[model samples]
Target: MAHSEIHLELLLGKQVLDSTGKPVGRLEEVRAEREGDEWIVRRYLIGVPALLERLSTWTIGLAILHSLGARNLHGGYEVPWEQMDLADPQKPRLRCTLEELKTLEQSNSQ
Candidate 1:
């Protein structure tokens, strides 16, 4: 599908998955790169830093800074898309479930 279509539909709250066929997190946005006519997804930013930045505490900026450092060291996030079991497959466009996302975080962190 075209990136525009993907952007309009595939992003903004789809569940993300890890390489091991396990839940990883939910996509905050679809990071992409332009090459000729295609917009290839580079990574799924996972929403944590974005969420952190909205908070009213010293933690927000720190988390954003920390995420910047971490991403630099780890390189770009390479999301595994085929395995995504979207929270609402029926709608094919729905916000990821927070409870499922928390479950994914705990399961993948180890």
Candidate 2:
């Protein structure tokens, strides 16, 4: 298999599209784990909650939002690495429908 590299900085704020070309959300964080000598990406986190978590303010941010009547506000998706197509890097796309992905809240509760 051929190996490729993409800078995290470039992907961080880029919007990701679903399989049918619908906007999902911005790429906020990447979940990875070490495999021998390299770190392999396990999932990509997208949306406002992911961003708040990345910034170390998830709890506070959510509390504030909830208090402001945004009770339905929720975290983003925890897209499995295999579900994302990074062929273009600048324009990441999902390999499946948005509904097929697990939301951050769901993943956390699992």
Candidate 3:
């Protein structure tokens, strides 16, 4: 299988698809940690809360997203980095089914 190198900026707004090719949501933020000298992505976060967090700096954009029905401020869906397939850099898709990705709540984030 051919793999593509994707940068964090390219992933920010890219669409995410489930294993079944269903549209799930967009890649909002990446949860990463520094190891030695490089930052490694641990999991991918998506959904309303993730979107809100990304747009927190832009109050206007945040307000618009909230108005668009993404009112959930305390939860998000998380897919482990290993579960994601980045072969198609333009469209990142998950290897596992939607149900497999864990739904993280407020407590989990902190």
Candidate 4:
């Protein structure tokens, strides 16, 4: 809709929800290709949730923070562009949500 320019700011802090519409991850950082003076996004560093599934939210939160090498806490996930679902123009974060992501995880284990 808005074009490439609108997509610039969207690279940072983009919330990446699972297919079930549950918060699973977010965009930790974006790696861009640099040519001469211009730096264009090449890929992204996803923030994966380090918290154990059954662990207390607070406990997992701290672990997630530690894994991130950050002083604070923020549990999420990291993935490549191909893994994310970008269907809706409005919800530019992710379409994978929790439930769908769970299915994906389960299948990957087998």
TM-score of each: 0.37, 0.93, 0.74, 0.41
**Residue 79 lDDT, candidate 1, scale 0-100:** 39
Q: How many residue pairs clash in each candidate?
A: 0, 0, 0, 12
| lDDT on C-alpha atoms for all candidate structures | 0.43, 0.93, 0.78, 0.49
Candidate 1 vs candidate 3, lDDT winner: 3
| Candidate 4 residue lDDT tens string, 22-102 | 666555555467778767555444454322332336456666667889764333444445455555534555544443333
Residue range with the least summed lDDT across 10 consecutive positions in model 3? 101-110
Candidate 1 colliding pairs: none
Between prediction 2 and prediction 4, the one with superior TM-score is 2
Q: Lowest lDDT 10-mer window, candidate 1?
A: 72-81
Residue pairs in collision within model 3: none
Model 2 lDDT tens row, 1-110: 77777889999999999999999999999999998998888899999999999999999999998899897765699999999999999999999998888999999999
Model 1, range 11-64, lDDT digits (tens) per residue? 555555443445544455444688998776643445554333224332555566
- On TM-score, the stronger of 3 and 4 is 3
Decreasing lDDT order of the candidates: 2, 3, 4, 1
Q: Give model 3's TM-score versus the native structure.
A: 0.74
lDDT of 3 by residue, 1-110 (tens): 54335688988878899999987788898888988977777888887667766767545766776899867554667888899888887889999888777776743756
TM-score of 1: 0.37
For candidate 4, give the lDDT.
0.49
**Top-lDDT structure, candidate number:** 2
The alpha-carbon RMSD values of the candidates against the true structure, listed in the order shown, are 9.6, 1.1, 4.1, 8.9
